[model samples]
Target: MPQTCFELCAGGRSRGLAEIVTGDGNPRHKKVLQQDLECDIVGRNPLHTACVLGHSNIIQEFAKYNVNMNEPTTRGYLPIHYAAAWGQLDALRTLVELGADIHAVNFLDEIARDIAFRYAKHDCVEFLDWAEAKHALQTFISSVQSAVTEQDKGKLHKDEKLRCLSACKAKNDWLSNVKNPTRQDLINQKQLLEDTLLPYLNKLAGHPEIVKSGKL
Candidate 1:
């Protein structure tokens, strides 16, 4: 079968791709392409094909249109998976920048990094390792921020207050210890924070008077 018009346009990364997709009056073609355009051969959509071909220019075009970066192929492999498998570092970074989920796993339960490793793409693995660690740190930071808000504003029993305060102090200490820390440092510190706080939070959740108590 010949390549779909969308695939040709995407593979070429031409402005014509956008023109063709948007100018189509059918609407369904654009919708189906954006959401799910499965290829019988590779089960890859335009975006997936762009990644496999390391067509960063085409990917930038998709990013402009806010294309679905996480769209999975027939094998449940996302564009990032193809980028990793092909050791396309620029494409991988572009995907991540455009909000691709680094944690996304394929049908084989393998993440992008895992696929990179399987292919012995050492540089890709290194970049993925750093990206994963950075993502973990950012996630931990967001969680800690939310936890802090809960500690400060959420109603808690007096005993729970002390526990929250302790957790806060521990969080502060962990922050203080890290001075321009690397990704591994953040990973380790995040684990420590979780260990110190999660149990206390769980225990506090079991308190009988939690809901009844008003904000202190």
Candidate 2:
């Protein structure tokens, strides 16, 4: 199959190879790969075009070249925003797996989920919602672990350490079992964990060394 302009431009292929494969013989085509060229009309980069076309393979190719996955277009639309707007679920999933920021807002202050919802892309909306919730839960879990390991070391009493560890285990278990958690579920669990750990966190805060470490 013939490579699209996006594949040729973003694939990081040699100019000679691109010329041979594309057979376009346009010098601007060479410049397109050598320099990150934007679309004339919308000013979208090659990665954005790949997402708009729902080309997951091309998106992965962009990743191989260390292309900025979260880089927005001239209009402030990320590759993810393009995928969401175009209802490209597979492309969106690829971007998410590659660590694209799902929470990023465009110039219009609309997140990818908002774009998905506006376009009536229910699957994309659901996936973005779940992805955001999962990311938040994982971040909270990491913070809890870090507090126990880095912040509370030698500071928390044995009983307090046990309590924090128990709470962490419960959160891990909850995350393991959760299939599709809502944002409200994340908020509730976070609040519960905060309530459980607030006393210990406060105790740590009182320690001059702990406060100095800035890990709290």
Candidate 3:
């Protein structure tokens, strides 16, 4: 008789489970792995179970199987939340790299970072904080890129356009080369954009003459 799904998981046979579920092993076992097993009575899926076990290899296999990384359990705890709560830093990092929503809220309205803090998982907390700031910096960079494109299409004065272009390019270059930026680095960059390029672009966008001419 073949070992059961629960048996395989309990033994940490991630490779065997992957092969069975993906049909690389006995094709009949595929259906067995496909059915939900109630996830040890906690409403977790295989992916969530893998996260709780800190089995990042299993998580990667699940991702290849198209499992929803952000799927919430019955109580609204996402895989990220489980990883954070259990102090599974590596598992949490794997989830993040696999596109898990860092901002996802649990039933208690707590984010993964909040849970990490509550559980005294300082490493996970730091990683989540940095990830959020990096996301914000990336968003700001995209907006600056868009603004530069729009400025090229606008009817701003030659001097104004040159100034904006230079500033945007310098900021973009600096941000691109930034490595392991702290929160303060992110905040300062945002402040610079708001004070300089963004304000100039906003002024151009709101200018009555530019708006009337449809050149903003």
Candidate 4:
């Protein structure tokens, strides 16, 4: 008789490797790993660990076996995109060095940069910005446009206003320390700063909380 045990490796709990690489890993992975490059493994195989456990180390292991680091996930996002979105800076760098195509439309870079910013990982946010701009992807750049449009429509909230202000200032300070940002990136930064002013101005104009909080 032969072994027949297998384990699931979705984004939820899949550590990324043990289920696929480890010999003692899930038995079903053997066939999946052997699939051709064009196979639909994203939904079928696991992408969770592709950018995990230190982007550099995991990518290292993949390189040892000549895995396609640039391969897209089930949703069309490359492994670097996964690394970017998940705050895996080491992983992001590894994929890049491994020749992962950074210019591709990666939803993870857009989503992950925001996630990193929200968590105050300013370095990663800046890296994503540079990478996107260098690659001319315009993914994160478009997000700035969308945020501006929302603010101009007066559809933004208090927290959103604060976040925009922070992002704007941070973007400016970051640019001043590096090579000059493109006109588009700088323009977007200015717009974000201007957008922050509106909500604050509106609140100040009618400051209902001023009388209630007693701290104002």
Best by lDDT: 2
- Give residue 152's error in model 2 in angstroms: 8.1
Q: What Cα-based lDDT does every candidate model obtain?
A: 0.70, 0.75, 0.74, 0.52
Q: How accurate is candidate 2 locally (lDDT)?
A: 0.75
Name the best candidate (by TM-score). Answer: 3
What's every prediction's RMSD, in angstroms? Answer: 7.5, 6.6, 5.7, 14.2
Which scores better on lDDT, 2 or 4?
2
Could you tell me which residue pairs clash in candidate 2? none
Which residue ranges in model 4 land beyond 4 Å of their true spot? Answer: 1-48, 53-55, 107-121, 129-216
In candidate 1, how many Å is residue 89 off? 0.6
lDDT of 3 by residue, 102-182 (tens): 999988999999999999999999989877876665566565455556745564666776786677677778777978678
State candidate 4's TM-score.
Answer: 0.40
- Which pairs of residues have clashing backbones in candidate 3? none
Error of 1 at 193 (Å): 8.1
TM-score of each: 0.65, 0.66, 0.74, 0.40
Tens digit of per-residue lDDT, candidate 1, span 1-216 = 434545664557456565545645455665645443455465777778788778877787777777788988777899999999999899998888788888899889999999999999888898888778767655655554454456554645657556656665665676667565566776776566566656444544544342233111
- Deviation (Å) of 41 in candidate 1: 4.7
After aligning candidate 4 to the native by TM-score, how far in Å is the CA of 142 from where it should be? 28
lDDT of 4 by residue, 130-206 (tens): 65554432333334344544544564575765565466457546665757566466546545544544454344434
Candidate 1 minimal-lDDT segment of 10 residues: 207-216
